[model samples]
Target: MSDLNKLGLAEARDALRAGDVTSVELTESCLKAIDEADALNAFVHKTPEIALERAKAADDRIKGGDAPSMCGLPIGVKDLFCTKGVPSQAASKILEGFKPEYESTVSQQLVDAGAVMLGKLNMDEFAMGSSNETSAYGNAVSPWRRGNDDAQLTPGGSSGGSASAVSADLCLAATGTDTGGSIRQPAAFVGITGIKPTYGRCSRWGIVAFASSLDQAGPMTKNVRDAAIMLETMCGHDPKDSTSAELAVPNFEAMLTGDIRGKKIGIPKEYRMDGMPSEIEKLWADGAAMLKDAGAEMVDISLPHTKYALPAYYVIAPAEASSNLARYDGVRYGRRAQLAQGDGITEMYEKTRAEGFGHEVQRRVMIGTYVLSAGFYDAYYNRARKVRNLIKKDFEDVFAKGIDAILTPATPSASFGLGEMTEADPVQMYLNDVFTVTVNLAGLPGISVPAGLDSQGLPLGLQLIGRPWDEGDLLNTAYALENAAGFVAKPGKWW
Candidate 1:
């Protein structure tokens, strides 16, 4: 029971059920770890009082023999989730000091299941950037450093803090919302497991909106089993969220039989982009080989529209974001500008937003507004939507051929040093999502599992995109990959 903070979800659950350790002990261990690791900047808000109170209650529930699988486990909630009385700023300056009176359905579900919330973790401002650099509070540094290098690296974003915290064992797991590659890309960078279920699988009620149509909340955990256990607790129908799916939640962990025999896995040709790093190419091939050796069949497939995914995503996501972010005009609950005398409402709106939003958020909002404008709506917005449909259809066509899952590199490359790409063209950062945006555009289930390390000893991940509502099968395949890869390397903890 020692190093309780390092235990994964399933291990913690089993130990709690067996009466080997108290919830307070586990919670305290994580709190201590979080207190000592401030250099990581993973936690934006620490709620020790609330965490211990919940931990005590969870221990009582376990003692009463009425405990859930997640009962007494310590975890982190992304700042995007509206935890009542806790600041849910979404790492944006516009929402500074704004605490919701009600809780997000997904976080509340975790509470109902007896999970302890360590605090709100950091992320990119309004989930706008690929690197965690856009956060108003500053970036969440990765626990993993390049070989013999002293420079800090990004944990990926906008779920950077969740990925960092989970990878560093600050908490057992954390909640992450993915609009494009927010969850999976970060998970890959940090050498952890992250899954974005089919859109609407987790209710969006009370979670801060990025792209309403594309955003889905999911678990970022240390391993695939923990991802499965936490994801089950986070998903269900919510009357408050109109898009919430009404399907029954499956026991995802139970499907980890690791028997992928006869499962047809797709290796999409379009994923082989020009100038892709040899390390990443080798990693992808190795992953496919791993799955094939695990009794699964790998077949070559084509998703011709894959090339359009990033462009379509940029247009569609920004359009939705422009609409979604219009509410934070300084006249509402968040931060407002101090206007000079005679400054009217329009000036106030202009000044407040100019001062509040970070560079990335402002850029995207402008792009979104432009795409949605009357003159260019057809050329940009409508066309992007059409391309999105084609992209989704491409997946449907492949799945119709009986491909159970599609495997690809989770990211184009491994984690880069902080501030390394700040001076580069913004498109360089967008390329980080090259292998990931297709899943979001298609609204399919995708999971990223750590497969191997590059020459610099940084981690790389393999992605599995599954049929809609088939997360169980996807997770099972990832489990097979996990077992095959045997990726047990933890970051050398300098933090």
Candidate 2:
């Protein structure tokens, strides 16, 4: 009973069905663990009362034999999601105390499936930074420390809190949104499984807007199977989001046959970045070898536009972000700046924005504004969009040649110390997404599976990018990698 919080989603689902445990008990166990994990700073908003209430209902549903796979399983919601009446801040001060009146589409879908929401998790402010340091709630520290060094490490950003909460056993799983690798990079840093579904597969309605075209919600869980179960529930067509795909949602958990034999796995030479860590290089090679053992044919491939992906992503994401974030002025809601005597409307807007946004958020908004300005619109934004199309076409060309899945390292390196890269050039931090931005740029499905440990015993992950609308096949391939790698390392209970 005490260890119910540590159980994965599938394990808890089975335990609930078998009558060995109750949802209320599991919820209590998780709430207790979260209370003890303040040092991790993973869960920024605690909703124990709501969690227990949902758990009681789940128990009733189970008694009626109407439980879904996620019924009663305690999980965290990323702050980017607007849970009705819950503070959906997106971890930025600008939106501080701003609770949404309506629930985000993805979260509402999970509630319909009966999953319990423990609370809102922390993240990079507006999902901007690679490291979790940009979060206003403070860094969501990784549970895995450097080898006996006691240095607090960062659980990767944007989805950093989701990764930390899942890895630390504070929750069974958590919701994560990926825009330029927010979900996968952090999952890699913290040793969890996170998937960014094909763009438009998950409705963007009600989610706090960042780069609207690039944002997609997915699940971060303890294993590939758990991700499959949660992803199915999180995905569906919503009329509110014009970009939502009108397609049937598949039972992703049932499709995890782990039989990826004869599947074509593309190994892109462009992913082999200059000065990439030797350990990551070796880990990627080892992942390829394991897939070969599982009967996956590995073939060398090229995505020529890969070199321009990072630059193009930076330009385009900020441009969209600037446009989407303009509504946060003090006139509507959220924090308002104190006005000086006789200040005008322009002054009020300027003061509110300058005082509200953090360095990273402000930096992005400024860059976005500059790029979208009349003089630079064609020079930067339009050119970046063109490059983005070329990048997408590159993946299409590969898949046209029958590549079932593309394999790459999830991040350039393992988790780093909290403030190590934040003080340096911001590009040093942006480089963390080198291996991941291409996936988002192409609007494809991607997953990060914990593959192995580095020399310091910290976990590293391998990424699998799949065809558009083919997450079932993508997850199956990741399932094979998960089995082959057999990465079962857990961070010691330091938090």
lDDT of 2 by residue, 1-495 (tens): 668889999999999999999999999999999999999999999999899999999999999999889998999999999999899999988898899899999999999889999999999999998888988899899999879989999899899999999999999999999999999999999899999999999999989999988999999999999999999999999999999999999999899999988999999999989999999999999999999999999999999999999999999999999999999899988999999999999999999999889999999999999999999999999999999999999999999999999999999999999889855599999999999899998999999999999999899999999999999999999999999999999999976
TM-score of each: 0.99, 0.99
lDDT of each residue in 297-348, candidate 1, tens digit only:
9999999999999999999999999999999999878999999999999999
* Regions of candidate 2 where Cα sits further than 4 Å from its true position: none
| Candidate 1, residue 179: lDDT | 90
lDDT of each: 0.95, 0.94
User: In candidate 1, how many Å is residue 360 off?
Assistant: 0.3
lDDT score, candidate 1: 0.95
Q: Enumerate residue pairs that collide in model 1.
A: none
Report the Cα lDDT for residue 134, model 2: 87
- Cα lDDT of candidate 2 equals 0.94
For model 2, which pairs clash?
none
